[model samples]
Each structure stands twice: as C-alpha cells, then as structure tokens.
Target: MRSDIVPVLELGAYAAHIPYHMTWAHEQLPYTPEHERFLELECISDILEHLL
Candidate 1:
C-alpha cells in the first residue's frame, strides 16, 4: 500500500488507490503522469458510482 495515498484516503479526500491488474504484472507498461491521472479518475468514478 502506498503510504502517501493512505493519508488522503484516511482524511476523506476525493482520492483513491487502485490495484493493478494481473496482466500488468506480465507486461512492462510505462508509468507516467497521464496514466496515473487516468487511474485516479477511474477509481474515483467507481467509488462515486458505488456511493450514489
């Protein structure tokens, strides 16, 4: 778990920690800011859907 993300989640901010897919472990994907932002938005939308 990312300790940096823990604080945001614990503090009830609009933040999320998304787990990587098993396939990601088999492939070498470049970790970039755009990818991170996309994942964060995806997780946030998922959480919102669950809540609402």
Candidate 2:
C-alpha cells in the first residue's frame, strides 16, 4: 500500500477498514472532534448523505 497506493495515487487512504489504518490517517489529519462525535451518533450512509 505504501509503494503502490501512496506513491501511485498520491492520495493517502481517507477511510480504512482496519482500525490501525484509520488511527494513522487521523493522526496525519487535523483533529475533528465534531466529526468523530457525529460518526458515533449517525449511520455511515446517513453521514455520507450529509457529506455528499
């Protein structure tokens, strides 16, 4: 993933199924406490609908 995904696409994984990967991405990103709280409150589809 580091070689093919990171270098090839140049866009790091935004959302990963593995908890470790999600934690890593969140580390690189700016802290969003509200988003995290929303995720806990809403379904993924509902959250995506709000986003999309």
Candidate 3:
C-alpha cells in the first residue's frame, strides 16, 4: 500500500458505492465526506508514523 491508493479507492468507492452499497445521501450514505476525509488523515498519519 503506497498510501495514495486509498484516495483512488475512496473515489472508486464513492462512485461505485451508491449502487454497490445501495445507499442514498439522506439514508445514511455509506460514503460520507467526513469519513473519507478521515481516511485521508489516517493515510497521512500512517505515512508520518512510518517516516518518523
């Protein structure tokens, strides 16, 4: 995992998530902005943790 893959995944997840997860925006959507951002944060954190 180069770490950047997560963004690509999350994007694909967001795009495909609607039909794959069968979710709607108001109906507790599986892909939330906050959650995706959280994953980004986690990815950066993991990178920093590995570097330091």
Best by TM-score: 1
TM per candidate: 0.29, 0.18, 0.23
lDDT of 1 by residue, 15-52 (tens): 45565554443343334233222225345457676457
Better of 1 and 3 by TM-score: 1
For residues 1-52, could you state the per-residue lDDT of candidate 2 as single tens digits? 1222223223432431112334444244343323221232234455565468
- Alpha-carbon deviation at 29 in model 2, angstroms: 21
User: Residue-wise lDDT of candidate 3 within 1-52, one digit each (tens)?
Assistant: 2333346566765211212334344545243454433333333345454346
Superposition error at 6 for model 3 (Å): 0.4
Query: What is the descending TM-score order?
Result: 1, 3, 2
Worst 10 residues of 3 by lDDT: 14-23
Model 3 residue runs over 4 Å out of place are 13-52
CA deviation > 4 Å runs, candidate 1: 21-45
